[model samples]
Target: MVNLEGKGGMKREGQRSLLEKAIEIILFVGALSSIIIVFLIIAYMSLEAYPALNLDFLLGWFWDPKKEMFGIFQIIVSTLYVGVGAILITTAIGVPTAIFLAEFCPRNVRNVIKPSIELLVGIPTIVLGFFGLMVVIPFIRDNFGGWGTSVLAGWMILAIMSLPHVISISEDALRAVPNSYKEAALALGATRWQTVKKVLLPYAKTGILASVLLALGRVMGETMAVTMVIGNPRVAWIPTSILDRAKVLTSTILLDWSYVEIPSMHYHSLFGIGLVLFFIVALIDVTATYMVKRGVIK
Candidate 1:
């Protein structure tokens, strides 16, 4: 009987091992497939965009293919402006809110605030655009005096749209600091703010920066929400102020790419913008990572 029981146990163990191996194989294939898809996308965009890609072509602000002007520098600038605006706003509101929630707020209050903030992420971008269009834009136009669809409105929209991500990620980073570290700081006669600023913030630098990077990517890629409020136009020069209608690269693609005849300069030009956008985002990510690493080391 004992031998029979041992045999059954060995059979079950073998089955478990086989199952684990199968799961590992499945996971490996899934990862490999994602990598392949990413490479394929990059290759495809580069191939499509290479024709119109030029150093001089990208330096100007005009995009009329009929006149052979395809300068995207202003569009790039606008995109950067909107992104940086969103980042500044998000960092200001989201980081402080995160700190409050993570360090100061009561558990009951946090439970309410956290979920409410997260719900913003679920709201449709189009709807957010409408809210910007109806409420934020009107308020801006009435109060600040430009056409309601100013960069400030777009910045406000993006900031609101991105809050959940910033707050959630930053709060998690703050929360992840070991209690012992905080306790040590307190024991060393450090104030609460000092402990948080010197110890917790430094310790959780990676996650806070990760949140910023994530928001940066979202702000750069966001279409409906930003486009609706940016008052997009093909500018002849760089925008003089945040109130000047901001035409972003992604909006330019979404608004005009469908009707362009195939095998045309316009079509290829959009692709070129796409390539530039890819490189721009990649560069931002790389720069942010470098900065984070440097800060952590210091």
Candidate 2:
């Protein structure tokens, strides 16, 4: 009986050690796999874009494919134009909605609103594109004559698509502010509006800024919805007005994909655009990290 009890205890210890080892191995594998995947993607992009890397390729305005030429200037300008515009719109609408939800909305109202925003996030990209094409495109065409399929249309659609992410993240950030801060402000004779603008906003600025950067990243990579509404014009400058048609990086890739031959420079150019996009996202992420580390964000 003494021998059996000792053996049973040994088996239990062995099982526990095995389980711990297995978990450690699994976690290490997962982390290593993620790093490997990211590195492989960067490596592939670099290899493909290397051939076309030059001052001319980056600065040239012309993108004539028939002559086997490509330039990213126009695409870059359009990307910034659309991205900035979408960010502005999303901030204006999303931030206010977040403030309302976090500070003023009743619990019952919040339950409904939160679920609706969640639903919006759950909707697929293709469905959003279709909705934009069917509803937004026509509305712009009818009300804003001569602005058919223009940057304004794309900006509006993208702003709508970006709303859920901005609102959800910003709301979370705002709510993370300590209740004591608000109570202290109120006790100090500050009005609710003043307290929100002066205290809460300052405390939550980092989170709000991060949310905006994240939204910008989403707008930059967005293809389907923007492609449908942007009209895909072959312009080389930022659109002077909302009514002007513009060509963003994503639209250019999709528009030229079918026409480019295999192993061609145009094919390489697509990869180059992808590289540019990757770098843009990386820059945003890095900036956000820096801000967080610097104690700029609460």
Candidate 3:
């Protein structure tokens, strides 16, 4: 009886071991698949885009199909400007809104507002684009000028789209902070506002930074919203001001996909822009990761 019982225990242990090994294999395959897929995309883009990767080709700032010429330096710059501008606007608005929600709003108000704001994310980006087109664009044109389809319009649209992500992540970060820290600051007679400024902001900054990076990622790769309102101009520049008409790398492909043909120099150029946009995103992610690893946010 003792021997049989010991054998049963060993059998159960062996089964558990097999299950663990199976899970490990599954996880490894999942991880490897992601890496494989990413590499495949990069490899294909690189092969297709290599032909159009010349400095001269990229300087044209416009594609002339008859001339078979293309230059996207300004388009790249516009993408960067809109991306950065949107980040700035969203951070200003979203972070403060997050602070209000996490720190100031009554529990009841927070409960209602929080979910409502997040529902904005579920709202299709096309809806947001239309909001910019019919409403926001007209408002901007009325107030600021320049045909309304300016970088400012794109910035505003992107900011609206990004708010839910930024506010939610930032509020969660602020809330993740233990209540003890705030209590301690108040106990020491610091103003409620000061406690948040001194203690909460610093401690919660890592999460806030995460929010900014995520929003930047959204702004960087945005297409439809940018396409609808960015006023992708023929004679593009580095976007001297917010009111200037602009073009971004993403809009180039999506906006022109119909005319670009399947497999041509134009298509290759679009692929090159796509590859460039991919790297820009990867770089932001890598930089943020490096900062976190280096304790830059502490």
Estimate the Cα RMSD of every predicted model relative to the unseen true structure: 3.9, 2.8, 3.2
The most accurate candidate by TM-score is 2
Candidate 1 matches the true fold with a TM-score of 0.85
lDDT of 1 at 243: 75
- Better-scoring candidate (lDDT), 1 or 3: 3
Leading candidate by lDDT? 2
Q: Which residues of candidate 2, in runs, are more than 4 Å off?
A: 1-23, 234-237, 293-298
Q: lDDT of each model, Cα atoms only?
A: 0.83, 0.85, 0.84
TM-score of each: 0.85, 0.90, 0.86
lDDT of 3 by residue, 55-143 (tens): 86666665555567678777877888899889999999999999999988999999899999877766688988998999988988999
- Model 2 lowest lDDT segment of ten: 289-298
Ranking by lDDT: 2, 3, 1
lDDT of 1 at 155: 90
Candidate 1, residue 69: Cα displacement in angstroms equals 0.7
Q: State in Å the error of residue 191, model 2.
A: 1.7
Better of 1 and 2 by TM-score: 2
Candidate 3: which stretches are off by over 4 Å? Answer: 1-27, 57-66, 290-298
